[model samples]
Target: MDDYTWRIKMHQRRRRVRRERFAVLMLVVLSICGAIWYFGLYARTPEYAAKKLEQALEEKDIETFRKYAALELVLSDAYDDLTVDLFHNDTSLTPQAKSLFEKFYVLIKPQLVGATEDVICKRVSGGMWVMPEGGDMLKGRQLGIDYEEFLERSLLRSTRIKSLGEVTKENGSASIILEVLEENSHTPFTLELGMEKNDEGDWQVVSIKNYRTYLETVSPRIHQEVTEYVQATAGIVAKYNEILQSKQWDATYMSYSATGQLTKEQRTGLANYLENSVIPIVKKRQEELNQIPVPRGAMYLSNLRKESTDLSIRVWQHYVHGLRDDNIAEFNTAESLLKQMLATEQRIEDIIHRAAVSKAIPNMP
Candidate 1:
């Protein structure tokens, strides 16, 4: 072979060797990344979950609480109950588990609904009043509630404490319990709380059982408030009626509560419904009333299925999804559909002067 030819062949061989080395190096890098993800990142699920639960509890995030709570965490209403269960109960709770539960409760201190914030935060923030911590007589005085003022506040809010207790520790397990005192309702309702421990020995609540709360009941004050709200709605209802009678689709559409409470899609749903179902039935009814106009009263009617709330919620969800995806058309479609449904069932009987007349308008039927 010629010298020049041999040199060329050697050069080609070196290039091929370098290429093979480059490929091998790339493979090694990828393998290292995969290992790091599988072993280092993926393996910390429990720790991450525990941290998240703790942070959420501290932040008083109810949504996070619901998400994190599984089926085993104990929750209760009263601090006394929790302490009794923790200290006196025959169960032996792991230190880690106890700490987690304590911290979680601290996080939700303010939102104990009717409970005084001082009771929850004071005990936890400062040392226990008479706890038997080893070698340390921890005498810490935090905020104490002025029972009278607290009671007054509770009365004004129309909510009061029901029950508060923790699960007696039994065989290394404990539960939290809170009995909610409802207003003008059940005497003592109970909420069962549960928590799970993480790798770091932190107890994170995973579930709530019998989570009864006083928020469901409306106080007499609230009832009065509702009455006032209805009275306020009278003007809006009148405008709604007039807009319907005139069959001014755009005007009716514009009258919808399309602000922050109702999304763009929700407003569109009203518009579409007005154009289709609402206009037809309303027009027919108006023509009939015109032919034989009754002086007794103006009877407005609308049909609302039991699932109105559910459908509205679903449309809102769709709207949210569309917003996330930046799909304006899809969002508007959902809104339009919802609006049409609302309009179909919307009717108003406007006895302009006799607004006080109470007439039973069939809604679902």
Candidate 2:
């Protein structure tokens, strides 16, 4: 080969060598990724199984959970936590997990499998509730058992789980989403859970991440009892307004429910609740409203009515009768009366807010 030919041949050889190096590099990267996806993602350690078991526990899905848990974990913790719940007569658990599970079963299990399950199912298909671990989220550390009460109240409260789909797993750690339907607000709230396994091979929930759960209210057809309440409450409030204006104390007292009627025993409690709870707060809010000049325009009556309707629906949700019934007749009566009172409360609050806004703008019709 001549000098030119030699240069050209050398260039070609260099290009081929570079290409081969690049190919090898790509192969290495792909192999590493495949390993992570397989062992880290698909492989199940006792920890991963335990986490799934915990999710099953929160869901109260005993049958499905039974399959996910290890035999030892099931015999030890699972048995106690699921079978002997207050509502469940499974009788297959030790008294401790069973007794503790009772509180959870009474409060949350129904939402997972019973009638409430339908409501949740409609919200998220293949619906599963992922609860956030409670504590400092940065390190994903859990609170100690001694602080159980504080953990329960504080961890569950003030959490901000927006959607259940945000949960994912990394390494051996699983990120969970805690979904809860608030009774008073009638809204679905979510929070993130960070969990890991302890030395004992038992899974411990660590912390709640991004704790920013906010109010999410929805509008739908309410129960019939709630509708009845809206009408009855409006009527009762109209009557009460007339009674207050006409100074019919006796008749007003008679119209009040037993709790509100100021029975000899209840008078003190009512006075304390009204004085300490309602008036001071409303008056303070009114004072604040007085300082801030009302806006030039008022929210339309239709808009106000819509807001009131939504609020009424939310308040009335508490009257929902669940799976257990001591007596159907009693449930119906209590539910009806409760819904009516809630509707009245909604209407009264609506009127109060509108009145305040109206007074802010004297020309508002």
Candidate 3:
């Protein structure tokens, strides 16, 4: 072969190799670009956001949860829906009364919304509700509501997303329907979340589209649960009252206090009466009360009753020691404990009366 022909063939072979290398490089670049678009942009859709939100809630990933949820905006809209349902749809409320309530709600809406947001944030973060620094204690007392206790009873605290149903997107906005189950009631309900794409092209849940519907669906179950709780509590309270009334507890104590002083023989008799009679009865009642299962709604009352019973046991023990060892200070301590026990009893009665009169629970004694 001639030297010129060999050089021409070599040039053509090198040209072909260069072209193939360029094509392969371009293909690699396009593949990387496609992946960037899919994962970094297209993957951040409304449905993706909703799924992330569901996972965040399930895992209690507060930061990730907040990333997908516009908590303040969503809760604010939900509060409005709640008020509309409460005021507009109550058939028993006079139009004038409803107007008054609506006006009052508007005045307090900001504070209520802020408080609820705080509660939800704490709950999502797996933290207990603590009154914020510089909170208004006087106003809280006047409201006669325990926000923490209210949160404990609320459906929000127990809700779990069962499934993501459907997603509808329109003009940079979207709605996702979620099927949720509340652990407390074991009732499944649907929630529609309104979402919007921000300037960054990420979707965030901004509102609850059907909060009123959700409330209406859950309200009957809530009422039934409350009624059942009240009935069970009333039965327990009645049993406690019966135990207190069945014996002449006051008479037993009166015998010791009849005279300011007692002979040694009289003291011995009184000590025996307290130890063998009064103490056994009080201890038995306390044991029974301890064994009773307390419902969530009646926890405060149950605790108070338990405290009163404990004080009763202490009072009798002190009385017995005061008589046996002739210690006047023990007698004084018994008297103080008795006063505390009576005060606790009064508080329990006051709570029951308030609950009964408020029609919070019918047929409650």
Candidate 4:
């Protein structure tokens, strides 16, 4: 081929290669955009959630409104110290009444996980998820700060959102400024609704900055209460753990009040362990194990289970007297043997018949 012809062919090939690379680049960009859209990242942004929340409240769409609210995060726990002091220790009640209250306080502390904020949210949501069935005493009472009041000040029907700033995003978290005005209020408060990317990689509202300004609108005492409530939520779970640890497990078990108070701390099977009377039986077995010459951390049935079945049985017979825990706590020996008997009834009957060749078949247990 001539030199000019060869140059022309080379130029055509280079142009073709450039076009192919550009096509691949465009395809990659489109794929990324599609994935972002598919994950609903656009729909789950803080700005989008805020706007939807505002509209939901305005339209009285309680169901939709709940999706945007952090019910778990804001709610008080019935088991909190403040609540125990308030409802469980009233001075004027009769003895029977006080006893009943005490029983209820003990019963529901762990059972009723969410408290005032959850209660109010449920009411607002028309019982989308109600409180603990026996939480009548907490009715109509806001534990510390009324989340409703916060909503009223921050996002109520009469509240006007003055501005929504561009979302400030960091790695997997974001915040956006909002200026809002409450009904008949001259001051427009500035706040920031913070957001986080959930496990599903969707943005969710996690915090509201300077939102405590709403608490300031109330009385000083009310402000203090709200502040305390917020602070309590931050550390209350750990506080509960501490309180539980502070309890003398040995005394509670020995006094036969562990179940009436709380289930055995280290229960494996849920049902067998939670019953009121059964915990004492389990504790008695544990007490027997405690009397043994075993070293630290070797008292419980869990450690026993890790040993060979023969070892477990030997240890139980040596340390524990009645083997009640072998049946109820560690594993249900009676139930399992009965099941095995039923499963091998034919074989068992045949063996019995052979054994009874010299005597009549024994009556079935």
Quantify all predictions' global Cα lDDT against the true fold. 0.43, 0.40, 0.71, 0.45
Between 2 and 4, whose lDDT is larger? 4
Q: Pick the winner on TM-score between candidates 1 and 2.
A: 2
Model 4 local distance difference test score: 0.45
Model 1 lowest lDDT segment of ten: 294-303
Model 1: lDDT to the true structure? 0.43
- Pairs of residues at least 3 apart in sequence or in different chains that clash in candidate 4: none
Candidate 2 at residue 148, lDDT? 19
* Clash pairs (backbone) in predicted model 3: none
Q: Pick by TM-score: which candidate is best?
A: 3
Candidates 1 and 3, the one with greater TM-score:
3
TM-score of 4: 0.32
Clashes of each: 34, 12, 0, 0
Q: Look at candidate 2 and tell me the lDDT of residue 38.
A: 58
User: Is 1 or 4 the stronger prediction by TM-score?
Assistant: 4
* lDDT tens digits by residue: candidate 3, 1-365: 89999999999999999999999999999999999977897668887888888788678789988888888898788777766655433345678988887787677777767877776777677855544345553223334433433333345666777789889998878999888986555667888889987677779999988777876665444444544555665665577667656555754564565567677887888788778876787777667666766554455566777788889989989989998999999999999999878767776665554344332323322
The regions of model 3 sitting more than 4 angstroms off are 1-24, 58-61, 83-102, 127-144, 152-154, 242-365
lDDT (tens digit, per residue) of candidate 4 on 1-365: 99999999999999999999999999999999988885557676766766766676566676667676554442322133323333322334667976676576566543233454555556565634353344444432323222222232222334457876677877867787877765332345676777776665545566665445442342122223323333333353345335434443533444364345323433322332233333344344434433434311111122332232233233323322213243343344434443433433333232222222322222221
Per-residue CA lDDT of model 2 for 160-235, tens digit only, reads: 3333444466897776666765432244556555656656544444544433222111111111222333343455
TM-score of each prediction: 0.25, 0.27, 0.61, 0.32
Per-residue lDDT of model 1, residues 1-365, tens digit only = 99999999999999999999999999999999988975677433444444455555467554554454442222234332433332222124566776766665465444343233333333333422222223421111122322222222222222344544644435543456655554432234565555555555444554454332222222222223323334544564456477656655654555467353456666555545544655454445434334432211111211122233345445655654564455778678788768744633331122121123322222210
